[model samples]
Target: MSSALEVGDIFRRHGPAYVHAHDGHLGRVERRVMSAIELCRTAALGGHIEGCQACGTVRVAYNSCRNRHCPKCQGAAARDWLEARAGDLLPVPYFHVVFTLPAEIASIAFQNKTIVYAILFRTAAETLRLVAADPKHLGAGIGLIAVLHSWGQTLSYHPHLHCIVPGGGPSSDGTRWIACRPNFFLPFRVLSRLFRRLFLQALRTAFEAGQLQFFGDIAERADPQAFARLLTSAGRQDWVVYAKPPFGGPEQVLAYLSRYTHRVAIANSRLVSIADGKVTFRWRDYRHGRRPRAMTLEVGEFIRRFLLHTVPDGFHRIRHYGFLANGQRAARLAACRVMLAAQVPKAEGRAEPMAKVAPTPRPCPCCGRPMVTIAIWYHGQAPPGGPFWNDST
Candidate 1:
């Protein structure tokens, strides 16, 4: 057994049996996720050789899978994403808002992930922008960075969107910036009501368009009447839209985004041990004051829960909307700065909070110097014979 336990370890050990057993249920995305995690950073994918610049040490470095769902690859991905987003930050308070799907809706969402998740993003962003633009509210065009999280602390399928929104934005005419009160952004009740209405309406549209599919227990939802009943039930309930306190500044916002943007279902550090066909891992019970606790699950169950969060290929989990929309983000942000009367930012100082954005390379074990890539190899090619280096830090 490896000294450090990883989700990949469980997958590599029992993935074959799990895959065979669940062959009827698993989709291509989940199967690919399992295979990628199992083979990540292994010579099976092929990598390159690296040598120390200071010392004459040589080592074999394997390639990373680079799959978004792979736990080992998110750290570097987060760093790169943060570096790009750093310049887009505005000089204002930022709020963290979460929009969650109710359990009833979440059940439907699980079956129609791509459509429902897209609805979640769209409705959540629309809710924020609509509410902010109301004259009764901030009455400004707001920008937000929305990230989709499909798992809870216990790796359960709990879908939610975490949105980092600037406290204010340019007015309708772009003449001046409209800033919200220092402590308040928008009314939660108004946002919740609108979000619920928008999502159920969108779900109905998708259903009518023959875009939603159902199977197994939910197969009956394929019936128009049955689906309408589900939506009606979901509509009656109050949706949850929570806004956290304002961030201190752009630095804190960058720090916060760095953590949530590229997160996977679970990190390898949470694993305690795997034995007796059971996997032990740490989690926080949020209901109980976030007290630390450990839960043990059968290895197969663990793998299933982890794989449940694999998103569809080519689907973006992180998105920008309103003023931050990728197409007009640069121009809109420039206008916002000018309206706010903030100093023009220099290239070097744009993302000072992310000064450490570059990931530190794994140092040579023998001399503690950064290893330099000496040679590269393609997949299915034989690598130079040497000790396989553990590139993880």
Candidate 2:
């Protein structure tokens, strides 16, 4: 793994040139993402020294950038996030639902990410809540943990929300648990139609309120008539809202979240090669039966596509709604458990137990004995150079 080519490797080698080429077009967030990935786990971030007491051996461990967009930093972040969410899992089947933006609206969303993405989340959640609340449908209030993914397999901008919804919800009176039929959740046709209507309506409202911006190919959308026409065109097409089969259990849900929640546009493991001013990476072609395929893009284009996914600073890409909303999550979940007669988690009554961020025993590579921290260093400090360092230059 150490020898593998990473997004960081590409950034370290070509990031400066890419930034220079883009110049005025590159935003501050994108520039920071590139710099963080490039410098992650390198001496520029500083680190510490661990010495094995039994083997009398020492090693240098560099610090991670801990930037959310850095590929190298997501593993620990995902693990920690999953640990916290573990207790929230109910003993009920969970369904994976996806709400996708149509191409025309996605083009607009690309320019006004903050505004449009917020609308996507709100309207998607609202559609599900409204549909499920109808007595003709589920007739219950459900909870959703929605995660936003903005890139397709080949790194194109494709904004969509992946929602993990429990298969059941509390009855409107909070008197009983309501579960969906086995292996089924909501009707996809109903969800798609409602999602389309709500999203188009919200988009039009944003345009009228002067919250959305248009540029380049879509500059004409700045006109009210043109924006109205765009919304009309979008409303005519069916929005894509797919409900995948219910998860086998809560474990499958956790595994899925661990993989998707903190994912960047691409993973380091997917890079096949970076050579000759081009980068080759593996991608799954869902259109072709999910077949694995290799795509080669010019180094600059690869950088451009990666930067396309850096969301605006401080904008949340993951959100909770309905019963799972942070504001009322605990009380609502307790009520749900009582109605379902599910055993209450012990940790909930006391302090929430967190996964240990660092393992206590840092075993020596030469011998299976615990290592102790001997020294520490911060950025800009001159790290000791010798056999002790782990080549974190």
Candidate 3:
């Protein structure tokens, strides 16, 4: 199902004004995202004409912008990504863990995104590995897949890492599989304390090394005393480290991954309306039992919030750690299966065939005959044969 409301529609209507309003403030990446969303699946990009053989029906399918942040483009990308991960699943329960930064740190992260976000991933993964390997804990080497999300439901900057981990792992000596209690993964209090310490230490080191930048409200933190105060206050607060119950099985794990792995700040379906120059959209108020509510903001504000999540160019948001780390993923996974005495599961969903081979065209809606590409149109170019039927009709 598709929504009558789309992010592109919002962009098409108010984007230019928003751009003009923000002018010098918008970064290069934010401008690129806005441009991509506005032009996606439109004639601004090139497209082809598909004509039905039997009914002589023709339709113009515009090309996608393929921007990672675009809602329409993520569906295909998510499916493709999930298909690739299907083969990596093991016959073991998986746990969902989340590590979030406190508001102070989040403020700092907003200024130093690339460095701080990278540190968050590394420290979170390290905390998990360190805790899990202790004799008092699971005492094994675990595999993890972590994805970063930088926005809350209302598009606020809320940087966090979501980790999917198997319930058990190979022992320290590579001798046997060690599993956690059926109902428990790790003690959240322990995880929280260690994560807080490691993260703050890393932040202090970065600050001292002059690798982190302070801006706007946090600009005063450029002073060592002010920065120390910020760190001390954050260390006193309880960091959030949550661990959800283990998934029922591998299929459930895949289902959860499909939703989160490619999610943007907001999906188009959540958009309710645009009227009187104010855009209204649905958001979840988590503090209030997660009740659904509508929020209306001016066009510029909406675009501003959306741009808060445009990550630095070429920075990776999803990463693997420990046994799932890229260098030894295949070898470690094989060893894991051997420890569990389990057979390698056949690949579940096949990847799309190589793009070098053109796919069979879809049948026409009217005549049920295969449609052929009758013509190709580049950006700003009209159809070769002219309008087949009035699209507005």
Best by lDDT: 1
Residue-level lDDT tens digits of model 1 in 1-393: 344998888998999999999999999999999999999998889998887767678888789999999989999899889888888888788999999999978888888898999999999999899999998998999999999999999999999999999889988888999998988999999999999999899989999999998988789989999988998888899898998888977888988988899999999989999999999899999899999999999999999899889898888999999999999888998898888776847442334434654567779999898988878888788776654444552
TM-score of every model? 0.92, 0.94, 0.93
Which residue pairs in candidate 2 collide?
none
TM-score winner between candidates 1 and 2:
2
Global CA lDDT computed for model 3? 0.88
- The TM-score of candidate 2 is 0.94
* Poorly placed runs, candidate 1 (over 4 Å): 1-3, 52-56, 344-364, 368-374, 386-393
- Superposing every Cα of model 3 onto the true structure, what RMSD results? 3.8
Which number leads on TM-score? 2
lDDT of each: 0.88, 0.87, 0.88
Each model's RMSD to truth, in Å?
4.1, 3.8, 3.8
Give the lDDT of residue 197 in candidate 2.
85
Please give the range of 10 consecutive residues that has the lowest summed lDDT in model 2. Answer: 344-353
